[model samples]
Target chain A: MEVLFTFLPKTAHQEKLEKEFPDVDFHFTYKEKSRLPSVDILVTYGEDITEEDISKAEKLKWIMVASAGVEKMPLQAMKERGIAVSNVKGIHKTPMAESVLAHLLALKRSLPFIYESQQNNQWNRKTGSSELFGSTALILGPGAIGSEIGRLLQAFGVRTIGCNRSGSAADYMDEMTSFEDILMKLPEADLIISVVPSTKETKHMLKKEHFEAMKKDAIFMNFGRGDLVEDQILLEALENGAVGYAVLDVFEQEPLPPEHPYWSMKNVVISPHASSHSKKYVDRALDIFIPNLHKWLSEDLNPTNLVNLEKGY
Target chain B: MEVLFTFLPKTAHQEKLEKEFPDVDFHFTYKEKSRLPSVDILVTYGEDITEEDISKAEKLKWIMVASAGVEKMPLQAMKERGIAVSNVKGIHKTPMAESVLAHLLALKRSLPFIYESQQNNQWNRKTGSSELFGSTALILGPGAIGSEIGRLLQAFGVRTIGCNRSGSAADYMDEMTSFEDILMKLPEADLIISVVPSTKETKHMLKKEHFEAMKKDAIFMNFGRGDLVEDQILLEALENGAVGYAVLDVFEQEPLPPEHPYWSMKNVVISPHASSHSKKYVDRALDIFIPNLHKWLSEDLNPTNLVNLEKGY
Candidate 1:
């Protein structure tokens, strides 16, 4: 089998794949090349792939996305080309969930303020420190990542309210609410976390009305796509005290633009979309991919986390 | 039936006490007045009491310390006077445990660096983000607070090792080790949390040898007592890269001197002895005190969390 990887794997991973799968012809490159026409399988982070590349790749049968967010991929082109796509979905559950808790706890414990105070040798004790225990959290899109976050939050005695499109019950959630009914549950949530995927229905899901329904001191975090809510609306909500604080990991624009108002906002925490960036990221993704490769070589081809290109999950 | 409170209670708490215990005479004061001799019971935060106060309180039979630490209170004088003492020991479990997690997550997530980058309009993706998952944590003094911390860490898949006077098993801990065996376990801990009480046995518990035994990147947190390790030794550990980071919530000196090097060190996170400070602190402490008060009022006199005067727990 001829395979192409657009992203570089770690040296150990490279060694493992080359050593273990000696029958497969592997090519790794970032430069534009003619290898696309002959590639049978392509692995990527879903960011660099384009519709042009998809059109030229006549031999490509499968696209293995190493990252969870496959929104950037040319889903329509791949669908037309009959390319089967799979992502490392559950691999992010640990790192992403840990990131969510990190932001939540840091904001609640006033670590930013404490860090600032330390620079000035200030011993101010009035940090407005609060407990995660007994607080209510509304988690949008309670999939693997959200469920993991809910489980961790519950360990601290937090009430987890899971919100999804189907209003289906999920693990570790105290209650379930559909996306349409999120506003009704908004007022009760001390924290509102967005982990919903990027899709037609989910785009601009959180409008001004949703922010208005939230408590004045409610902490809002967006670990999902940034287009879930308009930046201006979130800014207005924060400025007017409709929402107390925001921990933003993803943004509508990459690098967030130097002149963005969020950079200057005291209540805003910008993470440069690095929530899922871990040393073990590539290793975990390959763990899922390597097993699927074995299944494909055996002619089963029943890969886990096969993405429905139309639904865009 | 006369009761004296050294600290002021919330209006709701005062109203509840006044309305419920109508026959009991309650006096709230911070002034050094002559109400000590007539008091049958005293309520304090264990900080303001002294040997002179104990000797002056001829009619005082019991001391209700509204805090976990009784190290500040004249335990010797109270024992000599045959005065009974009780403290709200378990009330700190929730907030303190949450604080420990807050510091851990904040450091692991590089919030301090993120905040700095935000201030400079730098969109840096290399945050060195790490997960609590698969990490090992050694918790010193796995009592109520440590057990609570262990439970929360366990949810994140962290291996929790509990250390106390006895090597007895504790809730939420994967394994149990005595303090004597801490050096052996130190190398395996990614995080070492101190929640031990301030006592002769625990004084200077983490010394130069202990720091040398830890992993190069091990994170040390002191939530137990400031005097558990000297400032000089900890500073040396951080300077020499023997320890990666230190989150100090307690210090040997209050309002840690302006000239202290810890304030300027990037690897050090300083919290002004405020980890236990919570909005619900008094309410939770009173929850334990009020139920115990019923026993005292009914001539039972026995209280929950009665301190062993000699051990100073």
Candidate 2:
């Protein structure tokens, strides 16, 4: 069985993958390259691959995406070709969840102001700082990353509520609600974390109306996708005090424009899209892929983290 | 039956106490003033309570301190008078632990640079960021706050080691060791968190030699008293790359001088000792203290969180 490694910035991560899978016959190529007829498994990074890449690999049975979001991939083509798609879902959970908690704690503890004071060597003890314990956290996505965040928040004794497509119960979550029902529960959340994948149903999910439902001092954290939230509406929410602070790690544009107003906003924390980019990220991705590769080859078993091309999970 | 509030800034907290303990006779006064003869319990805030105040309170059997640190109080004087002392220990755990995690995540994920770029409205993608999972964390104090931090770290799958006087086993802590043994283990820690109380033995515990033992790119966090670490030694470590970065919330002196090098160091994240100063802190402290007070009065039970006068815990 042949395995094809198709990813962008392939040269950067190729050495690491070569070292881990010395025994496997791996073909390292750009996502745009013509696929060989014998290719059975394809691994991709980013959105460099096209529909033609999927159609050419006649024997391709599996396509693994090295990212949490699979929205940009040619999902319909893969599904029609009987190619199973799996994603690097839970791998981003720790770093993403850590980022969410970092902003939440920073906002409540006022670390930015404290850091500024330290910059000026001032020992001003500003009042009105708050703790996370006994506060409510509303997680918009109850997937691997969102659930992991809830578990972390549980240790701090915060009430956790989750909003998902189905509105089903999640471990460590106090309550679950559907996407349409999020407005009803918005006032209960002191902090709202958006980790939902980008899709038709979720695109622009956090619009002006959702912000209107939030509490006065509510903090909004987005580590999922930039397109999932309407930035203009979010800014309006911040301006009106409907949103206390917005901690963003992803934006619609890769290099946010210099003239953007978010740069000067004190209430917003704009982080480059690097929340899930960690040192061990590649190793972690390999940790999952290698085992699944062996399982697919030997037992013809489907991977556990298979992503539905139609549903866009 | 009678309670005396003996703190200079007791008026604000005293009002809440009065409402909670309406049945008990409450007398509010500064520590320099004579305590009411009928007082059985004395509550104080600051370090320096006059000797005259202690001698005058002949009926005082129990003393409660509002702060976490009991170092400034005359422990020997209270011990000689057979007075029981209890403090609001672990009340600072939520905010402090959250702060430590905030800085650790920020340093690992490079939040400072991201925030700066956000200020410039530049959305740059940075590589080489590290994750907390599979990392090793060494907590100096394995008391309530430290153990609470341990629970938070467990969800991230980090290896947690602790150093305390007793070296007792704690949940979520992989191993416990004495302060003297910390040097030998420092090399293994990716993150070193100082949560130890400021005491004679612990003062300046993280000196030049200790910093030299840490691994390269290792992160240092000080949510404990600033006196526990030697400032000059820490600066040298940061400069020499022995300690990659530091997230300090407390300092030896309040309002660190503007000329201090810490303010300008890119490797350091200086916070003005506001980690535990959250808005809900008072309510949380009261929640713990009120229940303990009820136990003390109704059940004829001594508070479980009693402090050891000699140990200064």
Candidate 3:
């Protein structure tokens, strides 16, 4: 079987794969190529792959996304070809969930204001710093990462509500809701975390209407794809007191422009999409890949984290 | 039964107590006076009461500490008098543990820097942020809050070790060690959170010797009493590259003197002693109090959270 690996040009992961699976022929290429035949599996990272490249992989029986989301992949073509798709879903869960909690705790405990005061060498002992206990957390996606977040939140005694495609109760979630029911539960949440993968249905999911439905002092966090929310609407919400504060780890564009209005917003915390890029990420990713590779070599029909081509998760 | 409520200027809590138990005669007095007659129970906050005061109350069978710790209570007198001393030990567990994770996460994710940069409208992005997954965490105390912190860290896939009085393995701790064994484990920790109360043994526990054993860039946090660590040693450690960064929520003397060097240190994040003070505290404290009070009144030896007068936790 011929396997094609597509990613940003920087890694020895392909070399490691070649050593482990010497019998299987492997080709390494960038995501921009127009055609690639005899490829049984194509692995790509981030949102760099084009639909044209995906269409040309005529013999591609499976698509292995190196990222957690398949939103950027040619889902329609993969579905038409009856190709199986799997994603590296749990790889980013640890760092992303930890970052979400970091921002939530920062906002709740007034870390920003405290740090700012510290820079001025001020020992201002401000009162009314809130705690996470008894706070309501509404996680927008209850996948492996979201469930892990819920477990962490449960340890702090926070009430967790999950929103997913099926609206089924997860182990750590106290309540479950569908996407349409989110507005009804928004006002009750003190913290709203967006972890849903980018999809046609999820794009602009958290718009002006959703923001308006949230509580006045609610904290908003986005560790998922940026396009899932409308940035301009979020800015307006932050300005008008519809949303108290926002911690954005992902953006519509990488390295958010310095002149962007979000840079100047005091209520907004903008990170350069580095939340999930941790020192241990490569090792952690390999941990998941090694076992799955073994399973694939044995002709396993179902991959561990099979992605629904139609759903784009 | 005569009950003495100690502390100056009692407010709504005392009034509520008065209304709830009208049949039991209660004497509310300031900490200065020692004229209270023999009482069956003594309820007190953070005020020093002499052995003479406990001696006067010949009928005092139980002491209920309004505060979390009984370090200031006349434990010797109570022990001699054969009076049971109970404290609000687990009440602060959720909030304090949350604070520990909060600051640790904040430090690891560069929240202080991100927050400050956001204020200046700067879009600075740094790489190689650390993740909690596969990281080792050494919790200095395995009390209620430390154990709760262990549970929180478990969800993030961190290996949690704890130090305790008996060196017995706690439910959430991967390994439990005595004070003498702490140095051996320090080199392995990526994060060290101190949640130990200020006992004679714990005071200045995280001093120069202990800090010297930690990893080069390890993150340190203290949600425990400030006396558990020496501020001067911590400052020196940070300066000499022994400790990378610290997040302190408690201080030796708060409001930490405005001229303190920590206020000017860039790598430190200091907060007032407000980590355990939350909106839900009063209700949660009452939840424990009401149930325990009923048991005490019924003479059922309601030893739900009996404090060890010797250990002083």
Model number with the top DockQ: 1
Task: Estimate, for each residue in B22-77, the C-alpha lDDT of model 2 and write its tens digit.
Answer: 89887766654454567888777647565666788788888888778887777787
Query: Candidates ranked by TM-score, best first?
Result: 1, 2, 3
Q: Worst ten-residue run, lDDT, model 2 chain B?
A: B28-37
Deviation from native of the Cα of residue A56 in model 2, angstroms: 6.2
Estimate, for each residue in A22-129, the C-alpha lDDT of model 2 and write its tens digit.
Answer: 766778776545655778788877487678777777888888888878877888888888888888889898888777777776667676776667666676778357
Q: Which structure among the candidates has the greatest TM-score?
A: 1
lDDT of 3 by residue, B1-313 (tens): 6777676423666677667777777777777445455678777774566787887777878877766867667878889878888777787877676677777787777676676677666667764577766789998888778888898888778899998877888869998888878888899999988878889888887768899999888888887888987778888899998988888878888778888988877777777776776656665655666677778788876546788888775
- Output the number of the lDDT-best candidate: 1
Candidate 1 Cα deviation (angstroms), residue A173: 1.3
Pairing residues by index, what is the TM-score of model 1? 0.98
> In model 3, what is the error at residue B273, expressed in angstroms?
3.1
Error of 1 at A69 (Å): 1.9
Off by over 4 Å in 1: A31-33, B31-33
RMSD over all Cα atoms, model 3: 4.5
**Model 2 CA lDDT for position B268:** 82
